[model samples]
Target: MTINKYPIIIISLILLSLNLQAAENYKKFDLPLDLINYMEISLEGKTAVMTVFAGDSSQSFRMESLEDNRSYHEISYQGSVVLNNEGFMSSGAGYPFDLIDKTDVVFDNKKTRILFYQKDPESDVKFRSRKKNNISIFNDINIAGGDFIRGSVVSFWADIVINGEVNEDVIAVYGDISVGQQAVIRGDVISIDGKVDIAKGATVYGRVQASGGKKKFQFDRWTRWHNKEKDFSTIIRFYYDRVDGATPLLGVQFTDEDSLLPNVEIYSGYAFSSEEWRYYVGLEQSFWLKHPITLGGSFYRKLATQDDWLMQRNDNTVFALLATEDYRDYYEAEGGYIFGRFTPLSYFNVEIGTLVEKYTWLDAHTDLWSMFGGSKAFGSNFGSVPAAERASGIEALDGAEMASIILKSDLDNSDREARFGQSFWMGTAELEWLPDGWNDDFDFTRYFVRAGRFQSLNEYSGFYIKAGYGGSDGLLPLHRRYFLGGLETLLGYRHKEYSGQEFWLGNVEYRLTFPKTDITGLLLYNAGQISEEAGKLGDAEVKQSIGIGVSFEESLRLDLSRRLDRSDSSFQIYVRLGINF
Candidate 1:
């Protein structure tokens, strides 16, 4: 259902034209915040009244918090406005929509119409942050633009702009904040129920939080914070798997989180997967060289084997593999590498990294099932050329020195979820050298390509498709080979069920977001083929699955699927966070 938007737009324009009186001049009423619990509201001549319990001891403030020198909540009504079951809340129109339970507002005080939020229209979800503080904003405070001017702590109602250094927190309860690109904030910059545009390059020593979300022209701080730093910090993470046993990792990362600096990560990990321990140290520094270039390098001994790698999406999503721990893929590798990234344009990036390491293949399955597929001769992932042709068995080092190049282009214009309306492409070609001579049987050149696109069928619906291909010109060490058969590539199949030098996978999905309720429905299809070693791809057995899923607020998701390739396979289900990235 559509509402008349013109009237609301007019009301918004009128509100913007008026300089709102200080909340004090507007007849404030310290109304009880809990009255809404009973769906109750009472109004009188410019006054609203109700009962409420306050303080840790459930007593009135009476300035006790001030005397005790602590912050406290002062929630109340600014006008004698009456509230009904259809409560009212608004934002960006000289109104600070205090959030309690995200209740809806369904009316206009005047004959004006107001536009209510719809899930599809404002589908884009950027990084929004919240903090726990009892601070209250009351007056107007402005930090005038200047050259390196040191700022002080402030709270205000009128909008604010910071073009200089702020030594303290800046709070805007009823307005927005414009932080200049060069602005340096030593403390938080908070917009209480308002918007904030933090220009690119701005540095915030503390968090930038907003209660009613945020608007942006710069970096999606939340995305960078979580994706870059969080992922780096996960170097210390722990993993559990029946086959790998207990995997515990410990690490420390410096993402320049507290200042403008390069990122550094160091970590160590060990688990039963190979009963091997590894260590790593990495550093990345990004700067503008005509365009933007990130020069980074790392030295590490990490699990380069398929069995030890859980193969999670960069978005940190896990599917059917989370439920089934029967891992039948295994390998081992440890090395150090360095790389550089050059982003010549907004939508494109190219990178190169080189590593020298030792590769070893292991049995993912301790029993008989572990020894099948791939070469057909051994019925194991370590096949023909590498195993049969090698003087030593699979236990050998399989030494290799490799340089890799990766190119990626992304122009996904859709909201946070896997995205739609644009396409993203990434491909790689890597040449590995057998420094130990041609007899080492571990030299090969690998080529990989992956592309995806999201088509917006309408405001509330979209179609998404992903395609992947991987192949190696000579024998790639078992650890360096391609593997499919899980949520990331082929759904409903056993984790890493197929290990081969050449593999391809395809995925298609339709997503629909329900209006008003903020729920999304999804239908998914997956198919893939695996060639033991550059054999006939057209004849390779096809693996496929069909599934359906639902997502709430783009965070939680659940999928149920069935394998079409396996007749004896039962329904497979999964619960994971976010969409495929």
Candidate 2:
């Protein structure tokens, strides 16, 4: 659905054109402040109404929150109005007003379109920053007449002024790009939310494009505030599963650019079915000596799962709600850990951590129901048990405490610029050790490695291959074992039909992307083996499947797969969100 922004834009232009008004000119409405982060005040003659938004959108704020006292204000209607950020709401025009710092807001009563202030081409901040770096954030860039920049000049939340020559693209985000007389640009000149002013004598060898206006610029500020990339932001999330039922979670994350500390995250949630609370708090600090290194620690009590390789939480929730089928088991993990990470290269990182955790087995609730399949109850949470053990009875795992040293490494070169069929590859390795001398009931060492590569045949097609291996050197805990034959791993078989202590799997796919569209087609093949023996993957009977599917923008997908190893095998239908590997 397309939203019409013309009315909002017209309202904003009028308010910005008027000069600052005196405080006594217009009548004030003493509306009570609510708990939302945004407040709006709409005026119609002598009557003024107040309302607040959940974050920055149009959603009505109904519940009280203790998240923060800061909020953005929106004021509307024609009048000489002065507002102090004392908890009043606005109705029409959306101008960004910081309630904490800005003591007064003035709006115009006349209707007129106004443009943002233009940056001076000869400013020193721009000229000095040009030679130091080609890119600036929250700061303007100026290229003097005599200066020649050999590469692209980019500014984020800032403006760009050019009187000299630029060899590549000049881009400004939420800011303007001004090409002075006699200036030359070899590449595209683009402004995302601001204007582009090119003098008659200015030479742009490439395309010139400008989109959005000043009113929308204020909207972008609200967008950035609530965006995950923001330095400080809070998020509200809802989750569902057979074990937890319905869970509502709230999270806050903060980071300072100029400070030594780089990141902090806190989350708290409640599970309605289990009637339990979950929480997490973590912090990370970065040190720059010769290379960048980070040290961090966290404490958390969470509904944990190890089958992320099979399906993500949100995708599994859909299956659980619609069909009473959950592809993953759940457990309660309460733990605290400290870790250090080092990134010697942009696409690679290695982390070493020590984890101490107490684990409790979770039971699937039979009383809770799904939208469909109301007659079927949830399966036992116990994982990978043999046939004889399942025939006797399924029992919850004994609670245990264990300590382990963890080592992990990741390498990837995926192209973030492309939506699909990018020629990239990634690999990861992890190892965990629980020594017996630590007085823990579990004594084992586990290791897993996975790697994948994608080769773009062209803009229209691609080929992908992936393989993984997992095995244990000691007595592996029930929750720490391996399983195969599922939607993502083995499409033709039942969920987790193959369970064992060791496993190896391989998958290959050929993808075709239609031109000028988001639709894509795929041909897939899968092979895997699993066994009770620690290193019997090679000797175990191999299972195989072949399938075909289509996807829309790499999101929703449907596939029909059939087993190649069995004569009586039939086609199985599967739905998925994305390619897991």
The number of the candidate with the highest TM-score is 2
Error of 2 at 170 (Å): 6.5
For candidate 1, give the lDDT of residue 541: 84
What TM-score does each of the candidates earn?
A: 0.53, 0.61
Question: For model 1, how does the per-residue alpha-carbon lDDT over 1-581 read when each residue is reduced to its tens digit?
Answer: 12233553465345323312221132211222222221112222223232222222211112211112222323323322222212232221112222221111111231111111112212222111111111224434445566442223333345677777765466564467788766777656666456777776677655565544233223344543443332234454665433344567788886665323688888887766557786778888865322445677877765444322234422221221233223333445565667656554434455555565555444533221122222222124333234453334354444543433332333332333234322233333333333334344454666666677765555577777878777766666545677776656766876566767788888888988887666889999999998876756777988889999888877777888889976888877766565545
For residues 368-473, write the lDDT of model 2, one tens digit per residue: 6788977887776654466575433223234778788777889786644243434567889998866457734776778899998877666678878889999887
Poorly placed runs, candidate 1 (over 4 Å): 1-158, 161-236, 242-244, 257-261, 269-275, 306-310, 313-330, 360-439, 541-544, 552-556, 563-570, 574-577
Please list the residue runs of candidate 2 whose C-alpha ends up more than 4 Å from where it truly belongs after superposition.
1-230, 257-259, 289-291, 372-376, 387-396, 417-419
User: Alpha-carbon error at 375 in model 1, in Å?
Assistant: 31
